[model samples]
Target: MKTYTVNELLKGEQLLQQVKVNGWIRTFRSNRFIALNDGSTLNNIQCVVDFEDTPEDTLKKLNTGAAVCIEGTLVESQGKGQKYEVQVERIEVLGTSDPETYPIQPKKHSLEFLREKAHLRVRTNTFSAVMRVRSALSFAIHQYFRDNGFYYVHTPVITGSDAEGAGEMFRVSTLDAKNPPLTEDGKVDFKEDFFGKETNLTVSGQLEAEAYAMALGKVYTFGPTFRAENSNTSRHLAEFWMIEPEVAFLDLMGNMDLAEDFIKSVIRYVLDHCREDLEFLEQRLLQEEKGKPQNERSEMSLIEKLHFVLDNNFKRVSYTEAIEILKRSKPNKKKKFQYIIEEWGADLQSEHERYLVEKHFNAPVILFDYPAKIKAFYMRMNEDGNTVRAMDILFPGIGEIVGGSQREERLDVLKERVAALGIPEEELWWYLDLRKFGTAVHSGFGLGFERLVLFVTGMTNIRDVIPFPRTPQNAEF
Candidate 1:
């Protein structure tokens, strides 16, 4: 009379009570054996049904992907293959799936093919497990922040000022693009735009979150951020979610500690709650086809790496030190490095970041105090005058998963920095006003949510973690 989850059936117990289960047939071997999965868990329930007891017409109507409701008695499995199974008493066909029409079958389908059916791909083992892990990770993020006394803040999606000032934003306007409003000087008149000014999708919510954090003492924003870059790489996505946490009265070191703790908490939560889904991925998805054993390490490895890096007070080196290390290592000797790391002011590429974290440090490495010329204007300037107190957390597999810095709380410093960067000071009046009124020392970091999911799940491509991923040229359903 009551529905039993597939995970509940996994326990070895005989059921005296009647149970109803609804799921799609994963694999049906002959008339008596059917493997059904309800999206409740990674493991499917093998339902043993006798076709002779049921109608032959019903057996003929059943196919893979067809929805079915089974009233059955749960019993211990005597079969050698599986642990427990369900003995069907009454079978009801809720929906029939045509064998030829259903794209998903028992046979293997390529990842490219699955990408085409992004909506339907969740039914597959790999995507299903990924989605579950993604959900768990999101919950963990909120839980970690909430438990640590952080207020959740929602910032505006359409913003007038570019947070990153990287010129990568999708313009939102109702004005004609061919012959837009213009002033007598022939300059595009932003006053006539829909919002009476230029507005685009927010690239990051860190700046806005900082204002709230200064008031609330601690605040975080988890929302979708947009980037209009046209690079069609595995790592680049047109739209992605970002988790930005800002804390008042916090320095760069405190910011890094919060990031490390947040990452470890999410990793621990997923590994604890989604054990079945992760086990399925380890056994079926990430494993080699030849049955080569995948390296299985305890979940503690994630926390261990985080603690090891945090405990050592991450090797704080200026951009100059990084360059020196690169030079001494003889990066030119390695033919694999695309660009030679020579000068002090070179923007650290992904290759260089990976080299620092994976090779040099042999652990998670936090590279801080970047050259002010390369970093954003809001970053606090160091005593050295050239470098800013910006920090980037680099892991072994991914280069820069988290990026953050202490804000220039001083109004004079912020205004000077904005003027030097040639950014319009008029557009940033409200942001500057925050400093003018009552700005305390504050720091924050932005963690790319998709990248975090990829790192925890061991997913290689960014596209795999996000459902219906919006890449440069790809926006297929």
Candidate 2:
């Protein structure tokens, strides 16, 4: 007999057909009703077991987390929670779980408790729903880019380049670490290494994508990015995924429009296609915030927040204007901000970004033209000689979700900026060569894939969105 999934069966289709199904038993209530789920959907199929007909030994194996395959006839259910169920004829246990030692139970498990069992957490309702949404969001990203005439670029994961210039790199070396080859100048020799030069995992793919964008007109890269920052906060991860898109002949304003439209499109896609999973996550977030104080709870539900972003226009303000506003605002004036905003050159912190989005503008806001001293050297210098053409998109709950700028296309100006910033020019000779050979005005932005999922799924920590989080001092699988 052909096999069927729980999702296909629950669609109220072709009733009374013989079927074979495989799933794990979620609950064995009264030794007759087996709640089985195959991870195809959030809901499970209730399998009615006949105690008098089935052997006692086979019935004893029906427990929580036990994998089983069942052959039965579809029938209408009288249960309170579900609509249709399967009337079981023959059953076989694919795998058995000891109820006495199984970590996951039928009751709700705390997110903290679930992280420890990362391998098995997907068996639960919460993680399963989250992963499904995550999978859908990835698809939406590719679809949005593909439909818009953007070519996908597969950038290298390991490189001899430090694109960010922040120097937070995980060195990719194949030489002896304790003691090995040394140079005559009394320094470790990277010349004899595996690649014949020093290399590390890429922190961002923007530079490589820019090279492709100039050739392909429009290109994007969605891949893994690595960093070695020793941050144990709920926000930082050693490994994460980044979505970067570069376009030729696009300026800062056009970049802003593309960013906003792209974000809303993918979010709307998830809202439309993953309705059942999103509904489950929405209810989950609602229940989690019940015990918190009214002031501490989320102002809007998950779906409400998603809809607000889709329907609203992101407020745009120059960095200078934002500074003046912050200087006169209640947070700065009343001495409430942790990093008090005082002058124009002050880099905006999470606290400041949150205030602008949640309280000041009361909507999603984009701050642009940041100080040249704070932003990267690749950003095009403004006419004022003090600010760069950089923009950061800030959301209400999460502070900054997107960061990008118009890149410097002038060869002389870029070389001067590179030298002034004390960044090595020879290592980035190819990067500078792009400007030397027919460089046109181009722009791109980088978005953290996990952060977008966090905003959509109502997940708090960054680690929860990833499958196996690699953090400081925690690499346990």
lDDT comparing candidate 1 with the true structure: 0.83
Instruction: Report, for every candidate in turn, its global Cα lDDT versus the true structure.
Output: 0.83, 0.93
**Positional deviation of 112 in candidate 1, in angstroms?**
1.5
Which pairs of residues collide in candidate 1?
A: none
lDDT of 2 by residue, 153-259 (tens): 99999999888888999999988888869999988899999999999999999999999999999999999999999999888899999999999999999999999
Write down the TM-score of every candidate.
0.92, 0.98
Misplaced by over 4 Å in model 2 are none
Q: After aligning candidate 2 to the native by TM-score, how far in Å is the CA of 203 from where it should be?
A: 0.5
User: Looking at model 1, how many pairs of residues clash?
Assistant: 0
Best lDDT among the predictions, by candidate number: 2
Candidate 2: global Cα-lDDT? 0.93
How many residue pairs collide in each prediction? 0, 0
- Cα error of candidate 1 at position 256, Å: 1.4
Question: What's the true lDDT of residue 360 in model 1?
Answer: 83
